[model samples]
Each structure stands twice: as structure tokens, then as C-alpha cells.
Target: MNLETLKQGRNYCKSLTLNDRKILEEMLEDDFYIKFHELFRYMIDEDLKLEQEWFG
Candidate 1:
């Protein structure tokens, strides 16, 4: 959770290819998709709150 690590994760996500995304989409289907989406959404919300608290 430092800036460098977050930047690296962003870079890695940006590097994902179309095939990678398709594979990910296929993997996260149905009930699994709903659960994972919620978890991912929560992570993003928490990250936003942390950034606002620390940087703003």
C-alpha cells in the first residue's frame, strides 16, 4: 500500500492484453462474479477514502 506498489499494480493492469481480459471475464462469472465484484468495489472505495484522507 505505498504509492510505488499502487503504481506498479496500475502498470500491470494496463499491461493486460485483450485475451487476458477475456480470460478474466470468463473466470469471474455467475455468483462468483457478484461476490468478486463486491469485494473489488469495496477495495476501490477504501482506496479512494484512504487517498482522500492522506492526500486531500
Candidate 2:
């Protein structure tokens, strides 16, 4: 999920019990960006290139 979804989930957790909220918080705390960055770095090292035409 994205940052906005995390924020909304956190707000929703406010009404939950402390233990339940903590469980959800821990589950949501994975560092997704680091994993994504590593994937991008691997692609770059493998000579992957993006073309504007691909987007259009």
C-alpha cells in the first residue's frame, strides 16, 4: 500500500484496542521503499532503460 493508505489505516486503528493496533502497526511497518530501490538499482545495473514512447 502507499503512504496515504498507511495514514488512513493508522487513523482507523485509533478506535481499535491497543494490542490489535500494535499488531496492525507492526504489519504495516515494512520498508517498501528500500525493497523498491533495490529492485530499481538491479534493473539499472542490468542496463534497463525507459523510453518516453513507452509511457505514451
Candidate 3:
């Protein structure tokens, strides 16, 4: 769980955008690891949805 590292698509402190900040804020304000899982899940899910809608 190296949050400092840049992932393939998202969740990098240095690479985060404005909207990413909002999502991060939402994630950090929740109940610890469960929220962290939800946040990570949401990131992957949204990326999948966008890809499906755009290129499927």
C-alpha cells in the first residue's frame, strides 16, 4: 500500500488532479481500511465503466 507510488492509472499523490483531490478527500474522511477499500474499488470501477462506455 504505497500511496506514494504512482499507479498505472490513478491514486498517486504527485499525479492527482483536481477531481482526484475531491475523491481523496472523501476517501480520507471515512472509516479507515474499509473506506480505503471502497475508494480503491471505486477508482477501478469508474475506470472500467469509462473504458467500457468509450471503447467496448
Candidate 4:
């Protein structure tokens, strides 16, 4: 997720019930970009698709 999606997901998850948040948090951890330092390095394409694993 990008900065916006990360923030939005956090807010959205906050509004969810505990059970839902538990699942959502796990999902986010599995895929969200928690490390900004490695963002550019890990990014696959510069069409700015940071969500993808670097293929470049």
C-alpha cells in the first residue's frame, strides 16, 4: 500500500470491530509497506507501482 492507502486502511480498520480489525491487521502486515527505506529498492516498476515486488 501507498502512503494514502496505508493511512486510510488504518483509519478504516479502527472503525471496524475487534474481530475484523484483527483480520485486517494481519492482512496489512502480510503486504503493507512498513519500511519506507526499502520502498524504492523493493519497488518493481517506476510507473510508481510500489505495491509490486521489484522485477526491475
- Candidate with top TM-score is 3
lDDT of 2 by residue, 9-50 (tens): 442322334564454445445565553444334333433323
CA deviation > 4 Å runs, candidate 2: 1-14, 31-56
Clashes of each: 0, 0, 0, 1
In order, what lDDT does every prediction score?
A: 0.43, 0.39, 0.44, 0.37
Comparing candidate 1 with candidate 4, which one achieves the higher lDDT? 1
lDDT of 3 by residue, 1-56 (tens): 42222234243223345586567556656666563665455554454212222221
Evaluated at residue 34, the lDDT of candidate 1 is: 65
**Which pairs clash (backbone N, Cα, C closer than 3 Å) in model 1?**
none
Q: Candidate 4: list runs displaced more than 4 Å.
A: 1-15, 32-56
TM-scores for every candidate against the unseen true structure: 0.31, 0.27, 0.34, 0.28
Mind giving the per-residue lDDT tens digits that candidate 4 earns over 1-56?
55454333432322334564455445446545445434322221121332223222
Q: Which residue pairs clash in candidate 4?
A: 44-54
The order by descending TM-score is 3, 1, 4, 2
Question: What's the CA RMSD for each of the models?
Answer: 9.9, 16.0, 8.8, 12.3
lDDT of 1: 0.43
